[model samples]
Target chain A: MQISTEELPGGVTRVRLDGRMDIAGAQSVDLKMNIVAGSAHRLLIDLEKVEFLGSMGLRSIVIPARAVHSRGGKVVLFAPTPMVESVLKTSGIDALLPVHHSLDAAIAALE
Target chain B: MLGLLAASMPEALSAWPDPRLTLTSQLEDLALVLPWLQALADRYALTASTRFAIQLCLEEALSNIVRHGYRGRANQSITVECAPSPAGELVFTIEDHAPPFDPLAPSAADAAPTPQSIDELQPGGQGIRLMRRFSSRIAWEPTPSGNRLTLAFPLAR
Candidate 1:
């Protein structure tokens, strides 16, 4: 999986994730987050292009959500695909986490 | 800390503190863990609706790990981890050292069941499909050793 990281306004880092996010898919994301761990104020992961999100993928998101939040920052998920939407909903993240429908919409919320 | 336990524990497949009893790793162990996993959900004293979903998810997931992950390799080892979340939730994890495989890939068909019992609907690859639908959170990580799969469920209220 390839995850593109872009610096966005309002101190938010926009991550454009593409490809399958699963068991073999977590290493890169974990590495990416570790690189930007303390440098940014927030991270908005763009899931629009992500073709798949599985249990392991959800954990990847949750770990970052907890890790970033603990540092007094936050991680926002943007535009998850339908496959991811059900997982988020069943996991209750759809209601608990901040998920946006578009990157622009997500960036706007950070401001 | 976890490695210490694995190293010191006696080799017992059906008993406690056995890190080797993963559902995906060994098909025979499925019966060992399935009943207990179900019993935990039952002990939750949850409403029927929630209990059914939980049971379905747990059973199917364990089955998937056994049938899909291990791929019938002899002497396979799948690690199943169940821990309690700080929020009083049950977090069940299954990991295995097999060839790289992702069971959650979306199938070509995206249609609803033709009205069968949720359990009987047996949505083909739906065990995992429902696991993602039923659990609070599911995550995976590939270690140098194997694939680490974790499923978290909120305790019944």
Candidate 2:
């Protein structure tokens, strides 16, 4: 799993994941990003390149998103695959966070 | 992984270099380790027989290791070793210091799969059955110290 941050207009920071968002990726990437809870107000997580994400991967999103949410900040997950999106829906996480079908949608959500 | 492995990295699973790769007594760690296993197996182009069985068996084995082997000590550590034979048979070795009970010696009814109901057949005892289904061979070697399980599967095409 990899995370690279891209700054968009309107104070939106996009955290992109570019690999299998599995267990190893979850801990290494999710834990590190969750620390941004205090620092950032608006965040978008891009999971387009993630090949397969397991239940652990599903759990990883809750952390940073919730951390930011506590501060009244919002997290939008962008372009999750069908399977990953299914996991989110089954676990009720899709509703917990804002899910966008496209990067533009995510940016729009953040705006 | 194909890109990650090199002479420096050692593509062989047994000869794997990282220390973190060796310890897996914790379920949390298994959650960390399985993805790498799946990825490495995929990168190696492991066969479907190897992939599905090994993945399921490994998950079951690791779950057993966490629930029964380590007894959830939380502080305890377990060793997991994965190596392949020349014929592409994959051998996985897991050893833990839990009680010397053998999972194969007449698995207790309670030790069976997660049974679904009182009448209806459940998807239970999948652990033992899955181990049998996936691997051509499953052995439980007892030691004064702990239990050692060796599971072997054919490398995927």
lDDT of each: 0.61, 0.67
Model 1 segments more than 4 A misplaced: B1-74, B77-157
* CA error at residue A59 for candidate 2, angstroms: 3.0
lDDT by residue for model 2 (A1-111), tens: 787888788889888888765556666786568766556788888888776655446546666676677788878889887656654554445655778987788888876
Could you report the DockQ of all the candidates, in the order they appear? 0.02, 0.04
Maximum-TM-score candidate:
2
Model 1 superposed RMSD (Cα): 19.4
Cα lDDT of candidate 2 equals: 0.67
At residue A77, candidate 1 shows an lDDT of 80
Residues B18-90 of candidate 2 have per-residue lDDT tens digits of 3225564666676666666766686667864456556656666776777777777786767777777787777
| Residue pairs with backbone overlap in model 2 | B46-B156, B47-B156, B47-B157, B113-B124, B113-B125, B114-B124
Error of 2 at B26 (Å): 3.7
TM-score of each: 0.47, 0.51
Task: Compare the candidates by lDDT and give the number of the best one.
Answer: 2
